[model samples]
Target: MMTVVRLMALALLLACGLAQPASAQVQAQAPAQAQLRNPATLAVEGPVLPGETVEVAIAFAPREGWHGYWFNPGDAGKGMELRWDLPPGWRAGEPRYPVPETLFAFGFMNHVYKSPYAVLVPLTVPADAAEGPTLIGVRAEYLACSDSLCVRETAELIGNVVVGADGRRDPRFARWEAKIPPRIDATARVEREGETLRIAIPLPQTQALGRPHVFIAEDGLVQYGEQQAFYRGEDRLVAVLAAKGDANPSSLSGVLRFGNSGRGIAFTAERGPVGLGSTTPLEASNAPSIGWLFLAAFVGGIVLNILPCVFPILSLKALHLARAGESESAARRDALAYTGGVMIAVLGLGVLLLALRAGGEQVGWAFQLQQPGIVLALLVLVTAITANLAGVFELPTLAGRRQASGSFATGLLAAFIATPCTGPFMAAALGAALILPTQYALGLFAALGLGFALPFLLLGFVPALRSRLPRPGGWMAHFRRWMALPMGVTALAVLWLAVRIGGWPFAAIGLAIALVVIAMLMGAGRRQRGGRPVGGGMIAGGLAVVLALAVVAPRWIDEVEADAGVLDPADFSEATLAQAKATGRPVFLWFTADWCLTCKVNEKVAIEREATRDAFADAGVIAIRGDWTRSNPAITRYLESKGVAGIPLYVWIDRDGEEQVLPQVLGPDSLIDLAGASPKTPARGTPQ
Candidate 1:
């Protein structure tokens, strides 16, 4: 009865981007000149020698709430336009700006100077001429914005510079030069791998980086808001950024900020191999330590045992325990074998995941399920196991014999199936593992396996726990038969998942193959019951049919369309997300996959409810859903930006540009409360 209760619980548990054009030219005459609260003043650092250059600084002192744009104002705002009125013999160079801070507003990332800042332009003096004072003038037009409003402001300023030598030099030029990022001596290299852009800048490994960030000067080269991944080699720092648009340029210029030390270096990178073979991941300053990550992985593995997705596998383990408990040595042997099997499977998966990422594949945890071939294989295996548990034909050794190998195989199957569910604490560890060094990541995987096997291991080693189990007897046979129910449900679930991942025709072929194998197995069982030979011909025929069907199934496979949900969310892409957020409405973005059990549970419990739909309607929330059942590079990049390795991620961006990441496990009222808190506002026009 207890087995049936556990089985019942197990049954319940089982159940494109587009390129954006370059920034448009902002017409200076679009808006009337407003009050110059954030005003610009011009000055010259003078006593300029003939044939030499003198620096002219255009300084702006913005009000407390006002800010001015940088030379390359990120997503919105206009860069300063300066028309120079210089002496006939003099020439002005391109303007250089200091590293600017980032501002995210109305779904746009703006590069601006919040406080006092300066733009320096060098003035070249002619060799032939003037020794007296020369008049220099510039008409500076720029956009200044506050949190809620923006204004176009223009200033015309004039300054004097002595060409010969009696004029005093401005002392502030030294400070202003310090603000500009100095050009690095060594050239950098950048490579675009699919949707990712990797830039390698030559910097000594000894140099400390606080919170490094790369700001590309070229418009539409990379996504301005995506978080970057940094790595440090012996003499170079490599930054991985998400690429935007379809523009492929030969060379790129960017500024690399060395943390919060107010120091940065400007570099130009050519298109080439970034050759940073082996490097250490440089995490953010506030990231947790390795020990904490290990603990989290271990705890997460323990928690997975209770999750509904793993309950079917647990039933198998329970039956193994019942048989092994009769003998102490047998119990210990089986426990060790099981542990070994689990460790091998988990570590193997970890290595494969890392290897794929290293090879430039954008994939995450349980990536195998994303492939139709793998899902088909899993369906076949589960169906066979279900039949075996239901008193059908036995395999040569695994099903009929009680051997360590059988226990090991069970452990392998358990771990393989349990990974689709990411319990609490697992997300952080796995996310970090992706960026951590290979060895450390493997250690975390090992820790997870040990934790998963710990409970079963203890039962074998500790006689008191073993004694609590019911003695091995006739009940064991009935117990095994009943276990078939959950296994059958599990098989059915896999069949449904196959349909979702592949198309109906593909699933139908797979189902027919499973039935053929079951019929052959039943025949073998009847022959054995009659004390006649279970012919090898029947087994070979079944194997041939299964192999032939598996080979042909891919032909019928079609792209599975996303199921319509209650919220009726638009399909998620980077372009679509930007468009939705541009409307200045609250955005509710969630990512889920068909095979993810936890995501299904969440949809049923929290997301797909009428309350959530009504609340979002009231709040004017734009719903964007990312379906990741298949491999999607855009979705993978977004997940990496959020520092997560798996799905069921919820992001809420309010109308005011405030972003909040809700918990992975959602409550019944989580969406309702979130929507209710942010009242609806009139839709704002998209940023120009």
Candidate 2:
């Protein structure tokens, strides 16, 4: 008896004490990425022969009104730079850039690259060339600028070759040369629409350069702020774009910037689609690949259905429903019946998919992945329910118990969650599914869902499977208790994603509410059986959860999405912010990462303060601010999203927003005027 008592005490100590370490570990699940997503594409290549220089460049594919500077950035924008990851013997060189065009913005005129451009690097090899093959790799970093702000980034590009007695073209070098982005065809037509521009280029296959950029010189033609290029059919590449300023179709003179087998170059464009009047060897085309796409997506669905984060909750939900199953005498019979439900639901989805494909409908890999609001809502709901199960809060059982509950709920959740986990089989399945006939698509989906569910279903139908499970006894209790830990972990995760969208306040409120419910339940548990402590635990639990959810539900429903600000654009005018910069005074804009959302949204809406009309007014501010948005590439490198995982991105080009950042939110008057306070010398001729 003493021994058993001692063991129980030991187990309790471990669970409670180690919970912190476990929770901390769970929180750290976020990836430690090396770089933020930036605009420039990195390039690296080198010839092994002595005296041969392998040239490389950082290419910028800008949307419009955007340009980036050479190694030496002129005026306010950042300079393009390159880094190398090569072997010991291989030597790297700096960017050998083409002379830049003069860019005029605000009151400043600086030389930079406009449209898509590349920098050349001349690599030098020694007279004694290496006998074997050598490899060279590089990262290209550059800033792409638009009228509003700049996006800086480093990308990976690679090239390698063998060296011999004399400098000669090697087959490997030839291979890379082929991969070089092909130039834009000379014969293409540019068309302009409201906030959108389309360039029709004739092509048979979609080339990487189909979205190649172009500029329009005519008044009222071609928008700058929005530009997107895609292949609309099998015969042409259409560049869709947003029109800026005046956009008149006729009398529009456009210039198309594209790359040929040789390098980046431009061609003068006339208004209208490319008439049959001209034809080039190059044509951009992308026919729908119905068969392959469906196959890939189906495969992806299969893989994702079993992800760790998803699987546990699915099993438990089904288990709850399974209790309601009428048959209990034979466990095997119960398991088989549950298995039937899973197969039926999964195969049914496959049939539905086939029906859609028959209608010539287009489906993307997890086409449903784009709905952010829906994703967030589901995540919150699932995690919250799981939290309740873990004893974080209590709730009345919504799902009836039955053998089918575990299997049925698992099947349903698996199907839904599979959308985001496409991998491996994803490519082929999705490709085929989208293009194949309805019958074909459904067949592919069937294979995928069936493949995914087979393992779990097999385990269910086979009672011997119990042998694989830990023995159900005192250890089972320990396992159930430990299981609660994962529930807490899952709840924390859902809350984390929520924080990114809803901010820290929402998360804190959620945790706090759950806490209260737990407390109340504890209090209720002390009641006698007649009135009941059994359900008392549940009452306290439910209250804690409801209180937190009370805040969360309303916030979500209200959808109060505004830029969380240090500048509080509502507090100041764009013209006002710009005027501060024009006085040669550096207007410091501190884009806080989290009081609300990532710094990106407010960063763009706020930083691009001086629209064309206010250009001269806001020239002095450097727009130097920290980015705290989720997956914000620029800020990620600097560990800039320093506060909460999300919220109230503060602006401080003028003032640090230190006081505003305090209490973790922003308000007006929090703005500190720079000219009157800081004694630092002001910048010259800076744009407002």
Candidate 3:
């Protein structure tokens, strides 16, 4: 009986009511410094001058018993790395690294740092350097070592190199910046062979190793994190090149993050085989260790609460708790109930997935969103909840007593809407859950569920936290009444997304049903107590409309695939692109997912508009889209090749294959302009 009650509560909450907002848990745990056996800090200081080649240093701060690494260690060593983000119109000169020394550990000659050593980086300010505050962000993603274990960390360090009005040196820079010597005679070469693109950097001297320390850093060229690099000889540092998918060497080009003395050391790494642009064949999964997989899932789950649907519901919950101002025990009970509700939903999904898999359903991890029916159903649910949240309906039958029914309902509704906002990390985590051994997969999902439920649970268990509340008053009534606007706006937004997916007609139908449902709910509210006649016909109509919608929604959902009018090489057939170039127009390609809120927002207000379409038609532009609703290896490769770590990725391709990947957040005008940039030349070809 309790289970049934819980189920009904969940259904009502998910389908209509606004979510309760719990406090957002910001998990920013400090990475342990004790784990910093060989701590290194790189600082950029100079007698700041315009166009002066100068020195910046990377200093090691190793613990008494632990040590760090040099550029090249004799054997079994990981080099210290520094990555630099420099502003435009500026260049950096490579550092002259201090030679590494070898120490014996466990009967093996391990090259490492026994004390602090300084490796210098030379900065070269361009002759055409624009005068401004030069702020550089440095991240040290280094492998720190101890006798027993190695730790890899990425930490941020910042420095300001001010270019002066008179081109005079900043007194602060004189302390540590070093100038790169002129006429250095070494160059690094990158090449492609069957399974790899190999890079060889000539070392001025011999160093011991099975592999050399190699990093890829090129603007519009080179792959990172995926390439396999090895050292050949003391003077020869070899790295294998792997092209991002469909991104050909006839393709290779994009910003690459490579290793530097401080992390961004400039080595003229070679441009390997132009013919070796596609690197999809070599994407071998080194499958993350089980422990690593669990951690990733947990963290990913924790981040889910920040999604649009989740947060609003959480906000409502916060308001409810504030209203209750109850004891810690009460709060804890509420937390447990809420968390249990969320977990049951997740577990239900898991069981459904497992059952489908058992039944030989060809469903993947994205089975839910991939099905248009599911997406449409979810979209309708969102609309209903949003309307309810806007306070268009009054179902408060326990009118005399203040009940949190609505707040709890909102939280349930939020989970349904939020399911689609899954990020790459979520995909990766869920992928592991689906692919690993049954026990392992279940545990991974369990961890994720626990993580997602943690914040609300925290609210229940902490009384002091609960005591912090706003008393119910006139202000409370006003706030509740006004808060409905955002919910109304959100409903409109979801409706727009539906239109983009299925076209104007589907959007109209879905909307018609929502209006009918709302009108019935409102009419019923306005009716006298215990009187069913007023909204009776409306409710009957709404139910029938809903049943019809359930059948048609999936079909409509399958129709909408939206993108940022950016052009990607992978989306274009080279033959087709050649035609587009002949016309002298650019192309826009947008990659999207159903779960992506930002994508839906962009599609409605920008991409799906007739005005925008007509504008593109006149501009000789080309638009292509890749949807991530279901797994597509082709799309994955295209993204990786472009060096995008994540999506709603928008790429703009000029007539010359000059590409610009836009930001995650898209503006309508910017998207329209991106489409307009690619106009057909005199050889004018029709867009694909």
* Best of the candidates, lDDT: 1
lDDT of each: 0.77, 0.43, 0.51
Q: How does candidate 1 score on lDDT?
A: 0.77
**Model 1 C-alpha lDDT per residue in residues 1-688, reported as the tens digit of each score:** 1123223322332230111112212433333233465688888987888899889999999988989987777766667889999878789999998878878765557678998888999989899756888888988888777775565677878888887878787867766765677564345789987788889886643233557788888877787777789887755789998888665668999888755544466878888887547877786322346787899889888888876658657557767777666789888988898888899989998999887775446678878789989988888888888888888977632462468887888888888888756777777777667767678789989988888888888888999998998878878888888888888888888888889888899999889888987888899889987889999999899989999999999999998889889988889887777777778889888999888777888889999999999999898888889999988867776665454678778888888654566777899999999999987788764322
Quick one: RMSD of model 3?
A: 26.4
Residue-by-residue lDDT tens digits, candidate 3, 1-688: 1123224433443354322222210111123433455555556554456777655666667777666665543334445556678877666665554334446543334445566566667778877766666777666655555555444554565676666554454333322222111111123445555556655443321111212233332222233234354433322334455544433232221111222221112345435432323222212223244676678667767777764435434435444455445555555655665566556656666667666644424344445555545545665665555554455555552121144444345445544455445443454556445435567667766776677777766666765665566544666555655555665665676666566656777777777777767766677666744564566666787788778866665555445444444232234333444455455566667776655665666776667677777767676567766677554544543443332323466666676545565654566688677656555554365645
The C-alpha RMSD of each candidate to the native structure, in angstroms, is 24.0, 30.8, 26.4
In terms of TM-score, the best-performing candidate is: 1
Candidate 1 vs 3: which has more lDDT: 1
Which lDDT tens digits does candidate 2 get at residues 481-502?
A: 4555655565565556455545
| Model 1: how far residue 531 lies from native, Å | 3.5
Model 1: worst 10 consecutive residues (lDDT sum):
16-25
Minimal lDDT window, size 10, model 2: 637-646
lDDT of 2: 0.43
Give the Å shift of residue 161 in candidate 2: 62
